[model samples]
Target: MSVDAKARYAQSHEYARLEGDLVIVGISDHAQDELGDIVFIELKEVGKKLERGQVFGTIESVKAASDLYMPLSGSIEAVNDDLQADPALVNREPYGNGWLIKVKPNNAKDMEALLEAKAYASMVGEE
Candidate 1:
């Protein structure tokens, strides 16, 4: 269960990392691990607006399928097209090449409401 020190986490297991004006979003490493080998992902179109905690997408693994939630209110800027070709990237590098979406946040301060790496680790019992 690896946690990215620079990222904030939602209780549902999505992670958000601010980069310039965009926030990168993805499932936590623990989430990918628990889901086993990922086979598919369905994400919303770029430019769609979503509120925090709203379902933005879905990920399907050999073990099960799960909804992907928005960690902050934002408009989708980009979707990782690589995942469609190799969904296993999520299991290999959840915080890097496995990232799901890039969002232009409506309020950057919304990130402060999310759990830090340490808190998230503790919440998931990785601490």
Candidate 2:
């Protein structure tokens, strides 16, 4: 998994990127690599309000199913409809076309506390 300079990460492996007034959230590339061959993902509703560290969804792989956590508090603005039909896009592009959700952030300061690429890489032992 490559580092995204503009993104921040949670210890649980979720990534968040601030884009305008919205924050894009997704599982990190390292996470997909660990999960191996993701088969399904269940995301929360678009309008649902989520708190920091809340479980908003789940990702199922051939090996195991894991909960997806919200990196910060927000109301979901959109979910990646594309993953409903082709989940492999996550494996191919976890940070791009495979992004899981977008949220209207409730607290911008929460983002500042997240791990930076270098810190996240070290947390996952990439460094």
Candidate 3:
């Protein structure tokens, strides 16, 4: 699997990709693969502030349901409504169209602290 080198990941499997001043967030491909086919997603409202490592949502898959964590402290600017209609997009395109949220990150340093593609892949045993 090709992980997005531009994106950073949390130990918990959430990924954050910087785009201008906002950060795009989502579950990593590894997480979705582990959970199997995603069936439902419950997300925090837009404009809600969330701390790093906070449970911002829940993802239910064929295998099991999992908590979705915030990779950085910030206010959610947008949620992917597309997922409500086609949740499997998360499994199909986790690094692209399947992204879950857009956040205005609170700290640049926090963004830097996340795992790089190589590190994250190694952590997940994909390396």
Candidate 4:
């Protein structure tokens, strides 16, 4: 979970990138790497509201199926439907094409509590 100051992360390993009122959501690179080959992706529908830390979707990998947590509260504005056919985008570009959803933050103030990149590195250290 190599978080940058520009990004915020959850204990469950989901990440948030705040932009204006929108926050991009994705799983960390470490989580995807650990999951190995992803086989399927189920994403939250657009317009759906989610609270921070809520289970929003599921990622299925050769290793196992795991829940995806919302890193911040907001309404889902978009989902990367491309992932349904190509889940490896997560492995290929965890921070870019791999992003799972885009949301509008309901409480920007809470965003400050997420882990900084250095802290996240330390949190998932030496693995």
Candidate 5:
């Protein structure tokens, strides 16, 4: 598996990647690993508004069903529908095809508040 890229991370384990006003959101490799065998994912719909740190979805695993939090405040632009059919993509390519949503940021400066990959790695005790 590829290491989590140098994207921004929320303490809740959500990751964020910015592309213009679009901020892509997903759970980190570490979070997925900890969750184990994802069976179902419930994502916020496109056009949904969300606040940073707010619970927007849920991921169910063999072990548990956990809340998915927003890494940045935004209006959901798109959601990965592929997950409704096969949640395993989150394990296969979390940073790419498995991303959860594209959000149009409501506060651009909020991106700066997320933890960097290195810092998140530290927070999760990777180093």
Candidate 6:
């Protein structure tokens, strides 16, 4: 299980990383590993606005389906269409090409309220 040192984490296992003006969102490496092989992903449409902690989408794997939560309040700027065709990218490159969404946060400062990498790692017992 890998924790992104540059990303902030929610207790629910989602991660938020700032990249320029957009915040990139995705399930953590530990999450993908726990979920087993991913088969499908359903994400909200671009431009949808959601509050922090809102259900943004769902990810289905061979083991089970899990609801994805918003780590920050934001408008959906982009969804990773690549996952529709190759969901295992999540298992292979969770923090890279497998990232789930790009959000335009309502308040970038909200990221400060999330867990740091070391804290998140400890929460998941990866520390």
For candidate 3, write residues 54-92 as lDDT tens digits. Answer: 998999998888999999999999999999999999999
lDDT for 5 (candidate 6): 99
Per-prediction CA RMSD (Å): 0.5, 0.7, 0.8, 1.7, 1.3, 0.6
Superior candidate under lDDT, 1 versus 3: 1
lDDT of 5 by residue, 1-127 (tens): 2346657999998899888768889988889898889999998788899888788899999999999999988899999999999999998788888899899999888989999888888888886
Tell me the lDDT of model 4 at 2: 45
| Model 2 lDDT per residue over 5-114, tens place | 78999999999999999999998999999999999999999899989989989999999999999999999999999999999899999999999999899988789989
Clash pairs, model 3 backbone: none
What lDDT, from 0 to 1, does candidate 1 have?
Answer: 0.97
Cα lDDT for residue 72, model 6? 93
Model 1, position 115, has a per-residue lDDT of 95
lDDT of 1 at 63: 82
Per lDDT, what order, best first?
1, 6, 3, 2, 5, 4
Q: What tens digits encode model 1's per-residue C-alpha lDDT throughout 89-115?
A: 999999999999999999999999999
Q: Which tens-of-lDDT digit does each residue in 39-96 have in candidate 6?
A: 9999999999999999999999998999999999999999999999999999999999
| For model 2, the run of ten residues with the poorest summed lDDT | 1-10
Q: List per-prediction Cα lDDT, in the order shown.
A: 0.97, 0.93, 0.93, 0.85, 0.87, 0.96
What lDDT is reached at residue 113 by model 2? 85
Candidate 3 weakest lDDT stretch, 10 residues:
104-113
Error in Å for residue 122 of model 2: 1.1
- Total colliding residue pairs, candidate 5: 0
For residue 89, give model 1's deviation from the true position in Å. 0.5
